[model samples]
Target chain A: MRLQFILSEIGIGLRRNLSMTISVILVTFVSLTFVGAAILTQGQIQKFKGEWYDKVEITVYLCPRDSTVPSCADGEATQEHINQIEQVLESPEVSPEIREVMFESKDDAWVAFERNFSDRWWFTEMSVDDMNASFRIKLTDPEEYQVINEVLTGRAGVEEVRDQREIYEPLFDVLTKATLVASGLAGVMLLAAVLLITTTIRLSALSRRRETGIMRLVGASTLFIQLPFMLEGAIAATVGALLACVALWGGVHYLVEGWLGQNMDWIPYVTTGDVLMVAPWLIIVAILLAAISSIVTLSRYTKV
Target chain B: MIRFDNVTKVYARGARPALNDLTVEIERGEFVFLVGASGSGKSTFLRLTLREEKATSGRVLVAGQDLTALSNWKVPAMRRKIGAVFQDFRLLPNKTVFENVAFALQVIGKPKHHILTTVPETLDMVGLAGKEKRRPHELSGGEQQRVAIARAFVNRPDILLCDEPTGNLDPTTSLGIMRLLDRINRTGTTVVMATHDDEIVDQMRKRVIELQTGELVRDQSRGVYGSSR
Candidate 1:
């Protein structure tokens, strides 16, 4: 048969079963929406991790009253203590790993505290001498955070060492779990959609049993007789997938990235570009799912 | 040619057989009429040749292939050599007359060149060439049956199996369809038609096979419709 003839028959079948076609489209749309959402979330998580890791800092707070070692023996961290910390950071052995080192004195810490909580009544009794001075070191390779933490934790004037990886890991954990859950739900719904598509095709075939029987008796091949129904299902699925892409784009733009970017710029990674970057993938997934389900259903149910 | 050698078809768990241990032969270029009232196995006899139903125990052959032993994949190939015109006319309601006739050739993998030439020629033979663009609903009863016959003969099969081809038409339209089938048979295509119409059977004076309750009661050449009694 000619390609035009086959396509025309498919067109007619879709038109005749309009309601069933719409149902298939709607089911595909909802299923692919979840799939797109999961993908976008995964992309967002990766983007956030990359951006945050680049700026991650390991802060070492020096002991306040020890004054036993070199600069610290002169009471509090003297200029010599600051110089010793700076020497270790500028040493040739570790110089390549340390990009820049920042120093904070007790007075600077006190000033930052007052700046942050000047209006709060609880900070009125706080003083500059009560705070501990610290050093914030930025590394050339964020993955070498463990090496820096080990090197500085037991130093002469060091009080405590902390890496931001400890905090980011928990946030990533929650985001990853959410992505998996959404993907799992989408998978289940996709399976149900395939079954529903199969049933819809079977019913459509049954409704036109007489026509199919005539075609069979006239020596129409199994493929020729089945192509129309399969195409109908595929078209329905494609429509659904397109709708899902649109919904995903709108949801991410106005909802997640929109709200978070406006209020939480300090968090460093919320952006609309992340969701837009995943839009093409969503449409491709929708088309593939619809086509696969239609092919599978036709092969199994319309063989006779 | 079609032949049956001790053909017996029995439905599972049923008391009476659809066709008993019967043997018959239908020659090529012959117009044969199978006659009986309803439920007399006339339909079964037609269906057996089409491979719609197979004999339970004997060799049933059509166009030199044993239908009982033919694989399911080969059934469509066998059907290509045999045209079956159903009582209901089975025209795809959504298609035009041109498309309905073209369907027969398309099913057999005929090229578009052949279809464009052959479909109009066959439709012309059936006297419905001008009604090609009309749908089944747009045509009258006689025109629909003619379209069905045009589709049957479009592929130029060796044999045509028509089950009550004119069962729903008036006398005048029935005669028109019979004349068309007669003209087709004259071109050396064998025809096996099952019918309850007594006048056409007697007028044609063709070979007749009469069935009564799943048994062959009579088989005669140049036979009358009710003469078997």
Candidate 2:
């Protein structure tokens, strides 16, 4: 029976402050959407790392016929130079770091170069004689690129050692920084949501001061008097969270999955499942925001 | 029953004490009037019994529990045993008469069946039986006070505290309110009323405790408003 009274009180309070309640809902919705976006962006970064990191390779380029480097001053790499390089790769000192090495001859490099730039206007300016043969070395751990670089640098016929991860680092760095920016925005918006909820509850409590005074005089417990106001905030925040979840789901399903996935098939994108995974946390955060603000406001405003 | 032992209430720093170092006691089932001019501390006295204000130097005990020593969490339980009526009637303006009265029992978690039965009975006793559906604004001043009275007595409290319950009513309405209070007191509930109405005080001829500028000046059984002074 008391629960019925409290529930009815909550309804009355919401109705009495409908505009303020709507504002709270909108503020919470916008804030939690930012929170969901930040979480999903982090998830997207993890997906990218998982998909790309294992396939990265380190390439060791051999000197070309016209090379000017001191290590390659002996002119185009000889068969002996190639043999010595293969022996070093298979040596016990470096074999553990190297998963497998495929040697690409100048002809093979020329073919790949043609296939890549065939559509460009400068295609005819490059030829097989200008192409440098290279060893494509896959590592057991992509992070162990430095060990191979240290062993191969300045070696006979070796012109340059390049880790593929370096090429991808700037892309990943941009993404990670984007996630940080989103999280920073989310933090500011959440603070605004908390303050709006606090003010809404304070106004509600103040408007009903006469009723609250009577309730106090009639022996209503502090919790009993404050529950209706607290529930008012919780209900608004919960609705906002629900709206945020819907917005996130639509964004991930249509924008990320449908548009970005179809256009950029090679890049993995966050799915609706990721949005679902973050939904509960969003709702929990909303409730926690309401609960904390209500506790702070009610403590000062609803004292018997 | 209520007891005050050298109770003093100081509301602010460097201001006159609201209630001076004074002592008084009223036994169970007694109907007493606390009569004083404004600022004589009549409301403070009621507040002390309700545990709304902490006495600076002394103790207040109601229904055998030391209010000063009671923990904050236990105050609601202490107040539940006491019914209070105010000068403004203090009914929820939006709630119907029946809802206003039923609210008291509902807040205390009374069973639905008990509320369904007791609310109408209490309304009848306050002469607001058929007017249960009316809101506070829809009622006359006396009817509104009756609703307040019904809400106070619905839970069958051990003591009823009134702070100018008839202050806003005409003489005839005030008399009706006093008669209702007398009827509730006749049911063996202790009654403490604070009022400045001389005619009601003289007519009721109950025990009167008079305060003059925070000092207890008189206490008399079967007394008129200023007969003891």
Give the whole-model CA lDDT for all candidates, comma-separated: 0.83, 0.92
Cα distance off (Å), candidate 1, residue B217: 4.7
Could you tell me the TM-score of candidate 1? 0.77
TM-score of each: 0.77, 0.93
DockQ of 2: 0.68
Query: Once superposed on the true structure, which residue ranges of model 1 sit more than 4 Å away at CA?
Result: A53-62, A66-163, A251-303, B5-8, B11-15, B21-23, B54-59, B66-74, B94-96, B106-113, B133-139, B211-217, B226-228
Cα displacement (Å) at residue A146, model 2:
3.9
Q: Pick by DockQ: which candidate is best?
A: 2
lDDT digits (tens) for residues A224-284 of candidate 2: 9999999999999999999999999999999999999999899888999999999999999
> In order, what DockQ does each candidate have?
0.40, 0.68
Q: Clashing pairs in model 2?
A: none
Per-residue lDDT for B153-222 in model 1, tens only? 8889999999998899999989989999999999999999999999999999999998887888999999
User: Residue-wise lDDT of candidate 2 within B37-109, one digit each (tens)?
Assistant: 9999999999999998889989898999999999988888889999999888888888899999988888777
Candidate 1 lDDT: 0.83
lDDT of 1 at A283: 61
